[model samples]
Target: MKTNFLFTMLTGLLLFTACSEKPATTYTINGTIPDNSLDGKMIYIYNRDNNNLNIDSTVVTGTTFTFTGKMDTAAYCRIDASREYYVNFILENGTINLDLSKPVSPSGSPLNDEIARFFAAQDSMSDLIDSKRQEFMKQTEDKEERMKLQKDFFQNEWKPAYLAMLDGFFDRNLNNPIGGMALNYMDGYLSTDQIKAKLSLLSEPVRNTPSMQERLQRFDALEKTAEGKPFTDFTIETEDGNKVSLSDYVGKGKYTLVDFWASWCGPCRAETPVLAEVYNQYKNKGLEVLGVAVWDSPENTKKAIEELKITWPQILNAGEKPTKLYGINGIPHIILFGPDGTIIARDLRGDGLKAKVKEVIETK
Candidate 1:
């Protein structure tokens, strides 16, 4: 009996030691905004991976606040102080301090330190791009000269340098879950090979994440729908209880443009006049413009069409499925399909849109 009791005490001590050695799952955040103007204002914490916002909100009291919670992984989170002010850092199982002054950043965690370096490099590249763009815009008054500014700026300056910077950090933090955040910066800019290379930089487990899978799928869809390929066919139920198919408009012996837009999309609305001009100039010259409203409500779709005087044949309530099929992750995604239903150009914005339309219209 004494031997059994001694064994039980030893087992208890072993169990206690095991528990103590295990890593802590919960995280604590103590913040100081240092801006009294934000005193009593609400700060929202957003999970960058799955859902942005709707997680938690806390009130700032005298430039200080605290947040404590746990996450499944070393997920990245951004603190929203205002629309114009925010700071992003990894939410790991440790105390973190956020600085809200000019050049906002976070500290007190290893992931936060990595993110600081990453953000600094990104901000510098972005600032240089912005400065050059502003300088070019201010210097040029010629519409034709100004038209080439964006294309030139991105290809010549931003893409190479920005991607090189990413290559460095992604190489350094390949094992860290924060490395997954690099995917957010790459949209339509990176090619399949480049994207896959970056994805390979992430740890194996992270490569299997749902978000990563969706991104890969989107990239695949984009590749299949690339310019010079055959246009993808789609059909949607219109607001008036009629079925509208892409075949009915596109590939029926006319150059057809499908403007994938939503009512709530500001960029889409801004391009309304542009679309109107092109439709007017080219409709009589074998051009057809169709509006497919996705990621919007029926009421809003009708409201925008009426307000903007959108006379083009519109497919209302198109929703997300069509976008998923075409790999359109964002709004204002415009595609120009040839008479034989081959894609001529895609994602054409501003001057590129006008040029493409005019070029095709003049060709035939």
Candidate 2:
């Protein structure tokens, strides 16, 4: 009878202990924005999957708001109050107090000191690039010399420092909220080879996150596409309703540049003249250029073509057809195809474009 009682008591104790263990850590957020106008604004905390925790404005009698939620783990959370204001915080199982008395700066949260340092380093680099630009403008009359100088600066000085900063930031805090922003910036500014080299340094955990995995896939696709590999192609209708297939242009037995741009894009406009010059110089040497204008109105596109005096074959009014085909997220994207319809180079700009074209033409 005593043994039975003891067994029952032990089972009850274990059940009670299991039930009493703390629930997953929930962060209680208190935000105090001194300004009365901001009282009733909606705040959101987002993760990589666009999954977000939303908090409605607290009662405006006092300029303070509260939000409570559980984070599955230690991860980066983006705190946003509409499009104008945003701050990123590293959220764990603790109370988070946000004092938004001052406007959130583009430099990001001052609470994370390392993030501040990263921003400062980026600012310094921008200043250095500006100084270099001024120096180059002062000394160079020859276009080739200026191009060489710019290339050298990017490859040797700027790239190395940028990479070092990226490495340092990751080393300090692999889960830094600014890491995503930095990776995005690097994706745009660095070549596939450079990005690949840097990505090899990241820890497996960091590389395996959903966001990082997407970036890795993009980089892989870019590298494969740039190396003259087979890629999916599509057709789009021009303003005149003429179907233009990427395959149709490949029969010319020459290297082709498939350019993605838009009439409304300022960068595309600036690049038009450069492209025209390159096209005129190399047209006789078996180089063909095809422009694909995305998200452009027919009238605006016609005006741009007329203003630019572009004679190359172009396809506009394609809506999102070409964008989806190329997996294009950003504008001024270029993909070069060799004679056999295999993609050769991608995202080439300015002198890099010229150099790649020259190399391909010379080999042929």
Write model 2 residue lDDT over 1-364, tens digit each, in one string: 1323323433321221112445446766666665567566655666642334442233333567776666554455566654544565555444665655433222212223344455556666677678887788888988889889877876777766666565555544544345555665677667667776766665565566666676666665555555557656777766566777777776458888877888989888887877887888899998899988888887888899999898898877767766655656678888788877788887878888888888988778
Error of 2 at 281 (Å): 4.4
Candidate models: Cα lDDT each: 0.77, 0.65
lDDT of 1 by residue, 104-215 (tens): 4787776776777677666666776677778878989876787587667677656766665656566666666556766657645777788887787788766766677788
Candidate 2: what lDDT? 0.65
The per-candidate count of clashes, in order, stands at 0, 0
